[model samples]
Target: MDIRRLKEEIITYSQEIGIDKIGFTTADPFITLKGRLLRQRELNYQSGFEEPDIEKRTDPSLLFDEPASIISIALAYPSKMKTHVRGTKTDRRGIFSRSSWGDDYHIVLRNRLEKLEKFIVERYPDARCKSMVDTGELSDRAVAERAGIGWSGKNCSIITPEFGSYVYLGEMITNIPFEPDTPIEDQCGTCNKCLEACPTGALVQGGQINAKICISYLTQTKDFLPETYRSVIGNRLYGCDTCQMVCPYNKGMDFHFHPEFEPDPELAKPRLKPLLSISNKEFKNTFGKTAGAWRGKKPIQRNAILALGHFKDETAVGELEKVLKHDPRPVIRGTAAWALGKIGGKRVKEILSEALADERDPDVLEELEGALEKLNHETKA
Candidate 1:
């Protein structure tokens, strides 16, 4: 079998199946990346979400027997919604980052990879392929960068010249010696836009990110969000895109090649108040198919509560009080108390006082006291 011809045929087939960009690289090992992961772990900058085993994450040898090459694919997602949805002063809406706008990218990319795998197997009869999306041990961005899919922008996303940073990445390990593609040169020289624009200063000077403080990571946590980030998080319900939005390369680069990634305006930017009281079934039906729902509805609802507080939507005062008074989860109840304080009204002090009387959880009690302090300060003024 002619390896070069097979690689060419695979590239042609990838395009036919809607893969926006595809690249190949040797599966030797990501030596440089392993060091970064170790340093990040030492500094405690790593989010607990990362695969615990560093060796499995960087060495492709552990992925399969004699892995000769790795194939990386990128699918462009829409940055803007077809029908814009903005929050009204009375009815606030929470925004989900562009990445989570459509059907779960994992499913979409897996389908593409599976199709490519079948095509290669039919031609070579001995093609051994192992495909993985973001959930896998191998870093999607690292693989995509080395495979020449795009340069690693300071925002830590694969910034393809054609698709910008708004792309979903996935890779497949194969036992084929496909010629490696050239990685893109870094184009963000002297561009401090993303670093300066990061609300939480999550981006380190060069390109490293302290995931602990990243708004995107904080939003996905299934507990009370840190107070320092709550205000900066604003109306973001799922992830933060400020870094990508401010990137020079990402400007005027929105591609809608795959309809699967198209955002549903209502779900992607839903009203903040409705989210607080949404039923489990309703949440699943609307957002389950989207990537943002992977952490379940609690985090989204908690973020929505924070968003309502950020907007200071007095109209939501009643709902905030209700959540504070009755939400079973301490995190939700505590966050609600904070929101009530942010959206103070005539009954705000009374509402918090009542919750405090009934609240037993130490964290919730502290939140109650903090809310009362905010209200007392306002009243004294």
Candidate 2:
């Protein structure tokens, strides 16, 4: 079979399987991506995943002991849901920054890639294939860029004119040699909106990101969040989208209406009061299948208290005080203390004093001190 014909067949089958975009590239993206990963690792910027075992990633030979080509695919997310933008910190709107508002992309994209793999096998029984969504050693964004799907933008995300950056990427590494696509040119051209819009200054110059400072990374990480970033977290509970929201390419794109991705009406713009009151069972029931469900309920609950603190919503002080004394997670307890401090009053002060006496974590202790200071200063006035 002609390699070009096989490539064409792959694209056709991918589209037939409901993928939004397809492209192909040679299996060596390490030449461009290795240095970036190394820098991230050296700076301790990586959230948890180690620098992809470089040999496995770069060596097309390792991917498929006899690999000849890589087929990359992208699926554009529907762009229709306008994220809520009420200025009030009290508006505990459950917002999903486009990419996550639907069914988990990892599951959706992997399923499609598996189907594509089966199709290739039926056509060429001799060909062996491996499929990966975001879990593989391969540099997915680099592969997508080389495949002509898009270019890596200043925010370090792949950006295509057709889908902006609101697309999921998947790939099939096969032993079937095929003609490769030419990479697209970078179109970012002097624009720095994504950088400026970043809430935590994660996006540094020249397209580099310190993931440790990234709100997206912070939201997903299981470790305690530093106090400095607590207030800036604002109302974002699961992930941050400020950078993507400001990108010019994302403008005017149609919203994705995939039924699997739709937000549960109760979850979409939930009341802050209800979110504060939810039990662990309720949290699981509400977000179990959603992408935000990862890291379980602790992080989201912590973020909710932080958001309330930032909002300085007095009504939340009673609930925040309850968690301050009894929440199992130190991070949640600390954030609750901070929230109560910000919502300072006689009752919030009493809770802070009690929490301070029992708190063992130094970090939580510091937060308690900060809260006490705020309360004392208010009393003096």
Best by lDDT: 1
Candidate 2 deviant stretches above 4 angstroms: 50-52, 82-91, 358-362
lDDT of each: 0.92, 0.78
lDDT of 1: 0.92
Error at 76, model 1, angstroms: 0.6
lDDT of 2 by residue, 5-108 (tens): 87788788877888888988876546657777777778877766543577676666776777778888988876654454443544555454556666677888
Clashing pairs in 1: none
Model 1, range 1-381, lDDT digits (tens) per residue?
999999999999999999989999999889999999999999899989988999999999997999999999999998888898887999889999998988999999999999999999999998899999999999999999999999998888888999899889999999988999999898888888999999999998667999999999999999888788889899899999999999988889888888899999998899989899888999999899999999999999999999898888889988888888878899999999999889887688889999899999999999999999988988899
Segments in model 1 whose C-alpha atoms lie over 4 Å from true places: none
- The lowest-lDDT stretch of 10 consecutive residues in candidate 1 is 78-87
For every model in order, what is the number of clashing pairs?
A: 0, 7
What lDDT is reached at residue 177 by model 1? 89
Model 2 sits at a Cα RMSD from the real structure of 2.3
